[model samples]
Target: MPSKIDPRRSGRSGGLRWPLVWNVAWRDLLSTLRDRRTLVSTILLPLLILPLFTLGMPLLLGRLIGGQAAERQKVGVVGTLPAELRRSLTRDESGRAGVELVSVTDPVEAVQSGEVEAALRAVTPLPTRAGEGSGQLELYAKLGNLKGQTGAQGKVESSVQAYNRALTLSRLEALGLDETALSPVTLRPVDASPAQEQRAGALAFLIPLMMLSFLLNGGMATALDSTAGEKERGTLESLLVSPVSRGEVVAGKLLATTLTSLATGVFSVLGFLAAGLAAAGLRGRSDVDAEMMQAMGGQLTLTPATLGAMVLIVLTVALLLSALLIALSIYARSYKEAQTYVTPLTFLIVFPAVALQFADFLTIGDALYALPVFGSMVAILDLVKGQITPLHTLLASGANLLGAGVLAWLAWRSFGREEVIFRN
Candidate 1:
């Protein structure tokens, strides 16, 4: 009698096959989508979190700082002030008196009692005659109130400097000398970089760090659910018994996880952009005029090429994180156990993500580009700063893919082991 072949085992080629991989991947994707908890944790959470940090906090802080700056300041005077010096201390160059000067017996008590933001005490009486000696001026401010201290100290210093300049000019005229004779040269500063580059420098650290964090967080749930979750449900054994080879099964799961990770990353970027636009709109109502809005919009503008590079970086990071997460999840015996195992992995990702926020402190070199998480972070940071080098991009991308492949192989090997797959 001829040996009979089992139809269910007929497609087991003992190697990777595309059709089998696709089938497994599709099933995993569908299952993940149907699970509401996984969907929300991976997709919805990032969309909410990114916008809150990017838009809300900045607007709140801006309002607080602006309010503090716009309030009128109060200053106390301890001793009699000369007519000319009093005018100089009370009024600005534009003749607007922002400081309200009150005569106080004790300037220190006035500041301590919160009666004035700052106080000016005359160490010596002011000169009444043109040829009289200059008087000493002492300024006191409440050190506890930083905003009050800065404003009061700044106004007092400006007034003193103005008085000094005017007195110097008078003495120079008495000496039959021109004011400019004292200065040999004048210095002017010029910033050659474009406005866009300046704005990008401010945003470079935050954008990449948030993007990478979301990419990692977005894939984490699906990775754990697809592996450890299935094992906990007793469905992994049934899936393993299918005709598809173990490598094909692992590949399929990785593909699904990667897609989920990419989707989450894209959503996070969109959410952040939307939040920024909304913030701009709110600011335009009062703080931002049309000219300012136009200038800011131009500064924040991103080129299509830069956006493409960001997409590439996000995808590569997602692939690397998803593969590693899946391998870890595969070794876990239960869903709760997988979460316990993966929780610490987040810290690993966080340290590098935080480091990207200080990208200027890190050197961008071939060696950094060859490292795993650090390399991807540097590449993303360069892209945001508009300084991405093709060689560095290629190196970082290759390193990430190579690392993903290794983790994927480990996942496949774990799946092939009956003990690991069925561990409970």
Candidate 2:
């Protein structure tokens, strides 16, 4: 049996020794690696989740939209069609009349009651050709019922647009003007930055959130198991009685958890890369490829410096999260209790990740990069876009390391508290 450190030798023992740290860390790391739970969370989950989600999501959405469009919808038209339009136009290029036109006594009530998918009302007389009165047409659908309508709703809207355009042309021709008379200033969009198309794909924005999620999910198990699990199993006392300093013990657990999380993040990255490659392979083969390419945003244009910066940022975040989890876990009496305490930390990533979608609108300053999870996320966002801001990376990394140091210090102190260690 190991013996506890004496107060007389405490000063000397309090000093960190790498050999002792490694010994303690190795014991936990070896046990964690062998555990099936670690294998599932750290290896299998990371390797599959991203690719399956990124690749499968687009396909699923496409199926849903296409299926919605395919289902013939009931549209209520309140007014009669002009003789000319009734004869000449049954469907537009998108295959009009794809919907069934029915007469409804109450258009509003019909749509509200689900008697029709949508309703169209001509506020004025229908214009068949040039030299006619131009007016508005109202198309009504259940706006709040997005799920049931989805892509199929677009067909109803387009029919109304066609009606409005037809009326405009008729009015213009009546007034002796051309179609160009509809607008005094027409703006045509041009590609100002073709290079951007080659850099960040639409999917790149997800990288930051995914990376943080990887750290949290992959590291949480190991962190909880090492700290709370040891205490729960009544094994913490045996380790505490060893000659290892409390600081060294905390450092060792932090190191092990950080390493495990980093590995999981790496595997998650690999899953994304694999997804990208799969999309690239399908490029130009069919419309499926087009949809996937658009979903993926663009091909990876990452340079080594960018990858290195990502790796560096990932490491820092892992360290911080690992330490935070360990600290929380050390304070809990049981593994279940530790989980309840640490699970709320998910909101730390959830809020920033939700914000990442609107990144184009936000103006983030350099100092913001010094925030904990949010900072790393922003830096990684820039990195994913191939922006490679060294200052941002440096700021985020420095902040994360500083925060980790604080948390690790607290955990180290916690390790020395008998009440905390043996909490019932």
Candidate 3:
């Protein structure tokens, strides 16, 4: 009998064959594109999430809070207020307070019932004798209603402070003392950060985390389907029996997945930019005025060089994650099992991405640039802040690519193993 030719053990090449790799990659890409689930995950989801977060939520919040500011607020007063104090509460130099002072027997109940935005209860009489205590004013606002708790309550507090200051001044003058003597020291705060840094601070964490999530989610469905989906459908064995080496097959699938991932990320960024442009245009109308347009323009400060660096970082990270996902999926015997493995991998990516938001990128040392996902996140943040150095970018990209190479090698090796490829 002649010895059988084992396709898996035959036609092995020490180096990658581009033609076979390209053929395999093209096929996988076509298959993934044909799948509706893959298209939705990699493309549509980012389109929805980016606008909802960056544009829709901000506009919604502004409307809610802005509406609250413009409306008249009701404040329940528990006791009869002095004529002078009542006049002060109703209006001042800034203008009339947009508040309705209602006399209520039960101030807290009025607040709880939403009849009042806040309540002021008299605790004690104003200070008179040395032993006597100063008058206490208790303000109550519903905690769940943020507008009431913050905006209305803040306005009431400001009025009370002004009243207290005036009263203190009167008492001191009656004693023939200067009002300035009461305040021995004054303090003021200065923000040292540049305007660009301040704007970047608002968006640094959000942009990077969004990009990381899109990069991972974009490739996950395709990665699992290419590996375990084919295995469960009985097509993986047929592919393995072909003349192509396992390395080339793995490389092809990796390329396809990387491309899908990259496309998702690119589409997400484009979607975000489109949404931002729309918002800018809306804010640039003649009614909005030049100051508003200038302010909106200042928030988006990406230069050509920064955009190029960001694209490079996104692509490299997508490649690294794609390989890892492929390797993990290869171990799964079925598509469902592969999904279970890939789900936890999302947490691994998400947690670090979220945590990096709170990280001070400026203070973080260069050693952290050696980490895979974390390094890429930091580099993206640095780029956003316009502080990324060439060396830092090189280190992060090198580490990420090195890790990807290792994962690709492992996946290729797994493809060559009979038990893994055909495991039940």
Candidate 4:
């Protein structure tokens, strides 16, 4: 009798076969690609949306809000501007600088009422002699407003900082003391990162989360469709009745899901690359807030080594998520039901990624490298900072692989169950 499965993707006879697994995976993948919309959303959405957000957003915001360049911001001052403050107030925070001082009867009320961008309330009269007395001022701006904080508050702070510096120097001169007395300890920051790390940027923190997000989103529809969708469509029984082993079928579906997830991650990395390039291109331009651009993402230089490391981390994540999602999807009788089981897992990946934003403030122990998703997150974050610690990377990837193995085993067990297979 002729074999029921392809010789290229399945063994003539099998007890857990790779060939059969690949065959099943390819079959499901082809089915998924037939849905042209999924193909486009999976491949093209990230490429288009990420660049639009990263690059286009600032330009959109600049024109809409008028704070990126030398556009003058309104800052209310309750008292007369000292000679020192007058020069400082001529500038904002980014680009060359621009600030328009507006005298207000009520500085705080002016800011709250939107009559001013920010307000500086003078508590003490402007000192004529720096050594004789001190000047006190209160700065007010809407704390919850992003534009106000980033644009107006930044300008006020810079002017006040400059004013403080000038006053300090004058006081030192009045006291007949050298500048050295002002600082018992001078801590100068030095850049110790490698040349390739020049573009590590603030957005590096998002790389780990980006990997998780793509892996989760990219593979989810495929995983649900492969398991629950097949079951709901009544095709799962036919596939099960075929000559292929249950483990082989599960392995195939898992592989298909992982590939889909990996594809999403690849596109996501491309988006990150695009955003980085856009930031670099805009960094030196005069029309935009170049300083803000650098601070936000700066130059995003992902070295070949970093890309390789990211691939390693993403692979482990895809595998783990694929197996887990497959297991959850297999337990549900309907596609919509599978979504209920799988939706919460999305939040599990997210909360950890959000917590990583404060990674700089936290102390990560060596044991964290052995965790599941968070471990991979840490490894990816290290790669983002241009810090390649091989042991941690290996540990995290190995842990994810180990977890994936267990989940894949559970999924294989589920496929073997008569009740599970026919659970509709």
For each candidate, C-alpha RMSD in Å?
Answer: 5.5, 3.4, 4.4, 4.9
Q: Could you tell which candidate, 1 or 3, scores higher by TM-score?
A: 3
Candidate structures ordered by TM-score, highest first: 2, 3, 4, 1
Model 1 misplaced stretches (Cα beyond 4 Å): 1-15, 34-52, 55-59, 75-97, 101-146, 149-163, 166-184, 271-301, 353-362
- The per-model lDDT (C-alpha) reads 0.73, 0.76, 0.76, 0.78
> lDDT tens string, model 4, 303-408?
7777777788889989999999999999999999999999999788789988888987889987898999999988877876777687888889999999999999
Q: Count the backbone clashes (under 3 Å) in each candidate.
A: 0, 4, 0, 3
The candidate that wins on TM-score is 2
lDDT of 1 at 103: 83
lDDT of 2 by residue, 1-424 (tens): 3344444323235467889888878888888888897888888887887777766676666666656655677777788766544333235344233666788888889988988878778788866664555656677887777644663357766555766677778778878998988787899976553443433466666778877888898888889889899988988888877777777788888988988899898998787677767656655655543564565563344568988898899999999999999999999989999999999999999899888888879989898899988999988878766675788999999999999999988887787766787785
**Model 3 over residues 306-366: C-alpha lDDT tens digits?**
7777787888899999999999999999999999898887777678777876786456888
- For candidate 4, what is the total of clashing residue pairs? 3
Model 4 earns a TM-score of 0.81
Residue 1 lDDT in candidate 2: 33
Cα lDDT over the full model 2: 0.76
